[model samples]
Target: MKNNNSICFISFFFLFMFMLMNMVFMLYFLMNNMILVLEWEIISFNSMNIVFSILIDWMSLVFMMFVSLISSSVIFYSKSYMSSELNLNRFIMLVLLFVFSMMLLIISPNIISIFLGWDGLGLVSYCLVIYYQNIKSYNAGMLTVMSNRIGDVMLLMVIAWTMNYGSWNYVFYTELMKDDFSMEVISGLIILGAMTKSAQIPFSSWLPAAMAAPTPVSALVHSSTLVTAGVYLLIRFNNLLMSTDFILLLLLISGLTMFMAGISANYEYDLKKIIALSTLSQLGLMMSILSMGFKDLAFFHLLTHAMFKALLFMCAGMIIHMMNDNQDIRYMGGMSLYIPVTSLCMNISNLALCGIPFLAGFYSSDLILEMVSMSNMNMLIFFLYYFSTGLTMFYTMRMLMYLMVNEFNLMSVYCLYDEDFVMLKSMIMLLLMSVVSGSFLIWMIFSYPYMIYLPLNLKLMVIYVVIMGGLLGYLMSMMNLYSVNKFIMTYKLSNYLWLMWFMPSLSTYGLNYKFLNLGQNLMKNIDLGWSEFYSGQGMFFILKKYSIIFNIFQMNNFKIYLYSFVLWMLFLVMFMLMMI
Candidate 1:
């Protein structure tokens, strides 16, 4: 009864958000029509061009559709997924907030608007992750907050640099044409920010750790917005991205990241973490496509990846929830026979993930591989893509075989009804799309006789490679060679392989330690040549750090407000004085 009530409440909230989005879209359209109907001679073509440029268009609409689609499915999926949990109203509210922020992120006209939405989404995601208030959820939520802040800081720096050089346009490509600046520096900073958001190398561990959140969080984060923020940034600023030699950076780093993450996924015992790592690896593949000068292909991959990965996570959720919250695959064998629908859907999606032709992953991944093939084929990129494809199959089969095929000692037994109808329905939707649209979309995106750009008939060659790779991995699983490919086994000698080494993870503890140490050791003495701001002794340190503090007119409980007021006053005073 409570479950039914909760669903009704959340469904209402979902309706509210949808109505609001439609209202915004309608208002925008109305305003556009009004302007057109007025026949205003005052509206110059150049002025209209500027206004229209700021409006969200087809590309933004594409992302917006993804946001709405994934969010609605999650809302329905959550009816059963969270049915037994408490604080249900708050969860529903947060879901609304999550959807709102994602929609805002795409439609944002300026960098400021984008970051506002970005931080809002990040904040809501943190709350959702920690909603259960368990230790793992709390820790994971805190880490997400900190890592997202790091990305935010880099973005602020980009904004500052662009404002200085290109007049605060905030239209992404405006800065690309600025010849006075070093393209390398700007592109480097932008890519650095993208890497953090996308969970690229050295930063990849945070994503898998994020599995401590609910399965729905994992689904959305991996599929649509949070991780894709970086890719979206790169795509939006394609001109700037194209300016840097960073294409190689994206290629080599993304390929290596994919290989490393794929290897680590094999070691993951948690079902969600396994898929989480696969998410990271798959994003790396998309990034590899982005780096290969195939922006549209990358976006197509992003679209399909969102569908299939969300399906995988939702299925994983149903399985875990049914097994009474036991997520370890080792403990999950012989259950596939028990949950036929889940097993079938999961198998098909996992096969799609392994790039089985006629499935979603096959077409998009083939485009990426073909791009990699034509571009000065680095043997390493070639081998890594192939090897990752093989491993994708191996681990996916490992998951299927362990859950459905093998006989293992039961860890804990419980009888679960087939996943709720709503959850099952969503999974079915994803499954059908993953299977049918893969080929159709591929043909739509690329020319039919891809033979002109691709030797050996690109589509056929891709199908062949995928089959070969999946078969190799499947055979390897049968032979039990999967253990050797796991990252923990590969990295045993590193000794420092604990999850804390992840930059996002380390940044959490590292900030506390760094600030604490800095607070303890003040600069007492300095060479005169190195310090023009210094007075004798340590007086300079006080002045340097507290200059803004000295000018404050108010001291109160609200530190932030007081600081903002004082800063505003200072700006006002300066302006008035300058006018005189």
Candidate 2:
């Protein structure tokens, strides 16, 4: 126990120190407008230089700072959260490995090195997701890893394609190759990879499924390390992507993903999965804005979102811990009456998520909606952006009502309190950042404020939608058990919404059923039937039958011997005649 505590403290201290260092470096780089690239050539063959390269700039440094801060806090929180686990040391090591991989991904300018980090993130996250060693965790881990594998394959394709340029340092080529057809293809491949990593539309199922991981892992992976890896990669490649029609494809996919996640979150009952869906929705928002060539805004939102989302997960973890691992929101009610501090943190983060005025989320999400209004886009996209935004508020408010306002639904004898200082400390840190990080990032990232020229209705549209969504959320949550069951009346629609439009089923059984059935048929007809008959068992049967028949013939030893002797005598006589 002492050893485990020491390990946790050691890791937390180092990560915190590194976070401060990164913050200082980030400020320096932002002030001076400088980028530092450190390169080491591994090999030179056929004019292609295989080099390991690191890029140090404001963007990477700021991201590193945030990642380090979140990771350190999670580690510290885990000391209490995972204290009963025997292999706590292994968990810490895996988390450290995950953070290291993320750092590698953040700092690398070379795609090869980036791939090393990308693959590490996938593998390590799989380990974390299955940390509980249960069937659900195993299934979720498989889904998470397999979904990420698609992105890995895409990245491998990108690495192979970039070899044509004689160098895998994409930093050197993203701008120069913008007009090249091959580069456009590479950009598409990169988008596909990012989609899987960030959990875009088709790839979005894994994000919610991945909530089977421990809450600390959820806080780290969903917030900064794993899912955001895709968004960060896209941010890096924004120049190449913005130059082509692929941006439009990204735009459409991201918008749909945002809407799907928002709607799914509202229907979800599991607390962690609801939060995971919200993460998915936010990721969609980031990707959507980035597609529209607002990389800075996307990044700003990413950072701010990370702060609050991590805090939200930590608060959820605390609540779950107090609830004795029951994650169902239906059993949670009037939590603020018991664990006021945690409930306060949760509410603040939720409000931030809903883009409440002056909150961290508001700074980025509001700006994004405003920018969307200003841009020249069709009505469909416009509707998606605002509707998804409304859905975000709706789900958040609904969740809050279930957790804070409704009558207490748990057993009367249960113990729920906010006395865990370790957890509280971490949550408070993130809570502070979630409050201030947005405005701070805006000042740091942009040289000039965005000019908004909008009509009165357009300016108030966000407020109107949020208010409407909140009202609907409250009304929905207020429904009584004796009241009519709306889901029963709209069974199909409810099921569709509750199941994330059947995305998980589609990604899993929907995709694998036919192939699995084909494999079963092949095994039966080919390996078990035809191949067994023609080659294996049939050949053995034939050989055994012939051997038995020959044995039976040989059993008549006297007749066999007489026949052989006659044949020999005839042969001898014929040979003598010929010789004569």
Candidate 3:
């Protein structure tokens, strides 16, 4: 809560403080972090018992705590960001509903309960995405909603499949179904669903396009709630997936997704889009690790990434607000010299993102890297992880150079100040957590350290990649190696990566255009053209002709009656003559 916006800020802060306390209670409960399931029959009809259930353990508890924290922080930040807006209450309600759905998803082990939350998330996100009511928002909202609907359908399929096992609660049967052949089919569908929700590979266009939503929505969607839901689902079902070929497919798809996002981010200019891409990359990172059989590691990173990434989005929002809503980094420069506090927050979050020594991102990402280094992986997996890691640094550096080091590029007033205390007050808490959560989690989560042994150069491979990526990014941004004309020489290649391999266009317009054209042809040639005549107009004419023929054939006239009486009398006379 702040001095001016007591109602809005207090509501956010209360939930935040409540979750902070929940974290402490969770810590105390970790002494026996056992799985506990609570269920209640909600309705009974036609011999089917519909139930709602909650899964309580370290995973759900910690995830709920983080979701709560992020949602609260986003709402608090929105208080300042949306101060002049008239429909502020509506925005806050949507955010609360989003958090509630995410919580339902996090806690529910029952398939039906999970689906309820999953569908709620997709529907509410669609509303939030189209909140601006602009053409771009509408288009993006459609893309996002449709993309997620695929996952919803997949979940429904899984729910139906689960019926064969006699219950909607999947946790009860994940281990039992491990060796069952049907498990492969169920898990594959689940992976597909998760991939769509998490923005993996072919389903990735929506995440970046979803930047049409407000920045606070981005903070919640990208960081703690929406995207992570997919990875978390995978983590929960990871045991079932481990024995299936889908697990390897998940791993390969995830690695490529990470690499793809990282490359696209380096070529992007929009600030929120770049952050969204980073989010995509991190999600891929979580999925890859989870697929590789390190679920606890994946989960740890998921939590830590949520803290700093949310902070990073908040910082981006602050910058975009100050710079008259121009999110292009090319139009921003020398910001650190102007608004020092925000710049500091941005730098810290960026550093954390790059896997700096002891910040939040380092703990789990470092462990995952070291674990990957120690594992027996193919060249492709190894290359993808390290390459993705380095590109992360590359884009972060490039963005920093354009925003903070280059000369002032803004066309607005010269005065630069950080008087948005409400925003800063919300961001500073995350700033502290981003610095501390990694180390704290390390101590709390790991009872014993992992035994990672490697050769000297191999151990330092990540550092080398980070250094090379940084140097390359610096050269690309700071040096005059290519003029506009020179850069345009490779326009096709540049645009390919810059446009995320043209995924948005291909996924949105290419698919939609083809289907739409097909529908139009069918409507003209079949529905309204020949088929209409044959089915409707042609059949009407046939019925009309039959009715006229029946009317003429009718025996209602006097001539027809007299002819019938004469025939009957003639037959009787002929019979009497034959007898005589």
Ranking by lDDT: 2, 3, 1
Give the range of the ten consecutive residues with the poorest summed lDDT in model 3: 1-10
Q: Locate the minimum summed-lDDT window of 10 residues in model 2.
A: 479-488
Candidate 3 wrongly placed segments (more than 4 Å) = 1-7, 45-47, 412-417, 481-484, 516-580
| CA lDDT for candidate 2 | 0.92
User: TM per model?
Assistant: 0.77, 0.90, 0.89
Expressed as tens digits, the lDDT of each residue in 1-580 for candidate 2 is: 9999999999999999999999999899999999999988789999766678899999999999999999999999999999999889999999999999999999999899999999999999999999999999998898888889889999999999998888888998788897788977899999999999999988888999899899999999989999999999999998888888988999999999999998988888899999999999999999999999999999999999999999999999888888789999999998898889999899999999999999999999999999999999999999999999999989999999999998888898977665699888988999999999988888889898789999999999999999999999888888876543766788889889888889999988875456567889999999999999889789999899999979978798788888889999999999999999
Q: Backbone collision count in every prediction?
A: 0, 0, 0
In the predicted model 3, the residue pairs found to clash are none
lDDT of 1: 0.71
Model 1 RMSD in Å is: 12.4
Q: List the residue pairs that clash in candidate 2.
A: none
Off by over 4 Å in 1: 1-54, 165-167, 172-178, 411-413, 439-580
The models' CA-based lDDT, in order, is: 0.71, 0.92, 0.89
Q: What is the lDDT of candidate 3?
A: 0.89
